[model samples]
Target chain A: GESVGLHLPTLSVQEGDNSIINCAYSNSASDYFIWYKQESGKGPQFIIDIRSNMDKRQGQRVTVLLNKTVKHLSLQIAATQPGDSAVYFCAENRNFNKFYFGSGTKLNVKP
Target chain B: GAGVSQTPSNKVTEKGKYVELRCDPISGHTALYWYRQSLGQGPEFLIYFQGTGAADDSGLPNDRFFAVRPEGSVSTLKIQRTERGDSAVYLCASSPLAGTDTQYFGPGTRLTVL
Candidate 1:
């Protein structure tokens, strides 16, 4: 079945440095994409989202980039903080029905 | 404004037992969704409701799993004859509307089937 997947399982970055997590999705029909952050024992928290019509979207210290042609998505966190340590997931939505999530990438910010 | 909320943050059940997980979505949101997250994996779609009717349920694994939103504000996910594989974090989310809306998630209900 077509699904969303991440390029790496874990990413470690030093505090105050930039961090980028990558994801790959197989469904071309997907038009909306979102990035979520989940800490231990917590549900996913919405970070940022982007539409297929746009290539990039930015929020507070976070940016989401989408490449429809390559079926790729990326989340960039500026000046990574220790509080940013968590599992990040990318979700793709098609036709506003359901969203498929990737396995997730664990971001470890070293203090 | 309150965010999504799920009851009984954690549950432990034996095999073949029945369990129900509840979700209270954000006020005035018409779209609700449920997902299951297993260990080392992201959340997997289970079902979605547009108002009081199920708009999509293709993600449900089998017949034993069912969900309902009677008044379109709250939803309950029922699992009959639960199996060990059913153990996971059940997450509920809600969006203001269907198309291009961002979903806000609950704290989740972690169910452990032994």
Candidate 2:
């Protein structure tokens, strides 16, 4: 079956250190992608997004990199904070309707 | 004035029982979507609505699940004969327009079938 997956299931980083979470998607037909963060008991919150035409997009403290050639997507957080510790997911949209999700990477920021 | 809102923060039902979850989207948002998230996994798309009509329902697992949006605003997802496997968090999201619009998500309803 077609799917998206994360390279690391869990990652721990020191506060103020940078963090990078990687995802690999098998669907080349997907054109739109979004990143979301979810707390333990909450719904996924919108973080950032990138289109297939572009390779990168940045938000307040997060950056999304899309590698079309390798079918890879990554989310980078600058100066990781305790608030940034959450499960990060990469979702790809087809025809802008259905969104296929990666398993997700759990981020843990240690002080 | 608010983000998405879902009713019944938590639900506990026995196996083979029925459950209904509701979602209230943001004002002026025409696109609505439903997704299911299991423990340690990201959300999986279950369905999407464009206005009062369901535009894509292919993500639904089986005929046991159904949803409706008669007025294109509030939506309800109903599951019949829920099993233990149905235990998960049901998430609702809404977008202003179609095609890749930024989605605002609700806190979600946690359904537990035992």
Candidate 3:
């Protein structure tokens, strides 16, 4: 089945440094994409989102970039903080309400 | 100002028994969704509700799994004849609308089937 996938299972970054998490999706029909962060024992928290019509979207200290030509998406966190340590997931919205999520990338911010 | 809320933070049940998980979405949100997250994996879509109607339910795994939203505000996910494989975290989320709105999630209900 077509699904979303991550390029890396884990990412470690030093505090105050930048972090980038990558994801790939196989479905071309997907038009909306979102990045979510989940800490231990918690549900995913919405970080940022981008539409297929746009290439980049930024919010707070996070930025989401979409490359429809390559079916790729990336989340960049500026000045990563220890609190940012968590698993990050990329999801593609399809069929209006249905969402396809990647396995997730664990981001470890070293303090 | 409150976010999504789920009941029974943790549920332990024996195989072949029945279990029900509840979700209270954010106030005034018209779209609700359910997902299941297994160990070392991401949340998998289960079902979706819009204004008391199941707008999409193709994500439901099998006949034993069912969900209902009677008044478009709250929902319950029912699992009949639960199996060990059904053990996972059930997450509920709600958005202002269905398609492009941001979905806010609940703390989730962790179910363990023994």
**Could you give candidate 1's per-residue lDDT for residues B51-83 as a string of tens digits?**
999998999999999999999999999999999
TM-score of chain A of each: 0.97, 0.97, 0.98
What local lDDT does model 3 show for residue B92? 96
Worst window of 10 by summed lDDT in candidate 3 chain A: A91-100
What C-alpha lDDT do the candidate models reach, one value each?
Answer: 0.95, 0.94, 0.95
lDDT of 2 by residue, A48-74 (tens): 999999999998888999999999999
- Candidate 1's C-alpha runs over 4 A off are none
RMSD of 1: 0.9
Model 1 chain B, poorest ten-residue lDDT window?
A: B95-104
Rank all candidate structures by their lDDT, best first, as comma-separated numbers. 3, 1, 2
**Which has the better TM-score: candidate 1, or candidate 3?**
3
Q: In candidate 3, which residue pairs clash? A: none
Question: Which segments of candidate 2 are over 4 A away from where they belong?
Answer: none
Candidate 3 error regions (>4 Å): none
Model 3 chain B weakest lDDT span, ten residues long? B96-105
Tens-digit lDDT track of model 3 for A55-99: 999999999999999999999999999999999999998776788
- Tell me how candidate 1 scores on lDDT: 0.95
